[model samples]
Target: MSDKRRAFESPADLARPITQPVLRRPAATTMGAVLVVLRVLAGVWWLLALTFSWNDVLLDDLGLGDEPDFQALGNDVKEAISSGILNTVLIVGGIVLVIELLFALLVFRGVNWARVVVMVFATLSIIGSFVGWWLGGQEITVHTTLVTLALDILVLLALSSQGARAYARRPRERRARGSVA
Candidate 1:
């Protein structure tokens, strides 16, 4: 009882606190930088496709023809342009183009949110491209399609990295934890 009392009277020896996480800042920075670069490049590519092929893609092809019918294509394009779908497509597409350009700018500046937005849109765009290719049954070279798909996948993977996601989550993370990430 005396020994117990003496031991109890002595100051308690608490376990040492857990060590802080040794953050790999360099790795995070490198990954984040790569994601930004990929985002900018992919965004520019997408913007160009959206701009140059807007009519050919949405109007002349999908809106008018079954596949390679020039007459149907012309009629559809003419009707679309005259019947107001052209203006609607142009307006919406213009807005998207401007937003994408802004996103590209932000990504170049290492903005994580812009990277996330780019990734989302890039993924959707790639899917749409695939669907269009399939529907049109256009005889594209396998090598070209494969290369394009591979590049798109790489961009997506880079943007979806832990570091990129973490950076993007910075604001929300900070808000949730009541401190800056």
Candidate 2:
């Protein structure tokens, strides 16, 4: 070996693997996660509204007019409709809420796939809302519809931010290096 090459020896552990550290979660990602949680809260609001006002909601949904005399129906019919509406709401609403919660948690963890999934859902929701409104099928109330729309918009903006996207799409080595406690 030449004198320069023999001047120093390489570290014995140079070939061994060394874990890299993962950077902290970005603010935009945190915001996106929080926005998702807000969406879940909106879902809860709808569930509660349906739970408390199933009769009026059922009437409105079924085109029974704003002030239908629903009480005039026979007891059996009333009970049947009431139970059906409540049961449907509970089943469907509960499932959606759980799924939203799971996605929110996943987004908070900086999972790229989760972020993309949320973005897709948000886009769909925005488009569907506009389409339904244009067709005179969906109502956009200030208290309910508008609030949820805002949440979805915010979620999209946050998750689609440069910082959020970079952090979420970061290499697996960076992500896994410091993931363990």
Candidate whose TM-score is highest: 2
What are the runs in model 2 whose C-alpha is more than 4 Å off?
Answer: 1-22, 64-73, 174-181
Q: Supply the TM-score for candidate 1.
A: 0.43
Candidate 2 lDDT tens digits, 1-181: 5545243435553333334434878999999999999899888888888788876766777665444476577779878877987898789988988998999999999888899999999999988889988997778887558888888899999998756876776656445565875
**Across residues 46-104, which tens digit of lDDT does each residue of candidate 1 receive?**
55565566656664656554445645456666666544764665577567656755765
Model 2 is weakest, by summed lDDT over 10 consecutive residues, at: 13-22
- lDDT for each candidate structure: 0.55, 0.81
In model 1, how many backbone clashes occur?
Answer: 0
Best-fitting candidate, scored by lDDT: 2
Q: For each predicted model, how many residue pairs clash, with residues at least 3 apart or on different chains? A: 0, 0
Q: Model 2 reaches what TM-score against the true structure?
A: 0.75
Cα deviation at 130, candidate 2, in Å, is 0.6
Spell out the clash pairs found in candidate 1: none
Once model 1 is optimally superposed onto the true structure by TM-score, how far is the C-alpha of residue 19 displaced, in angstroms? 13
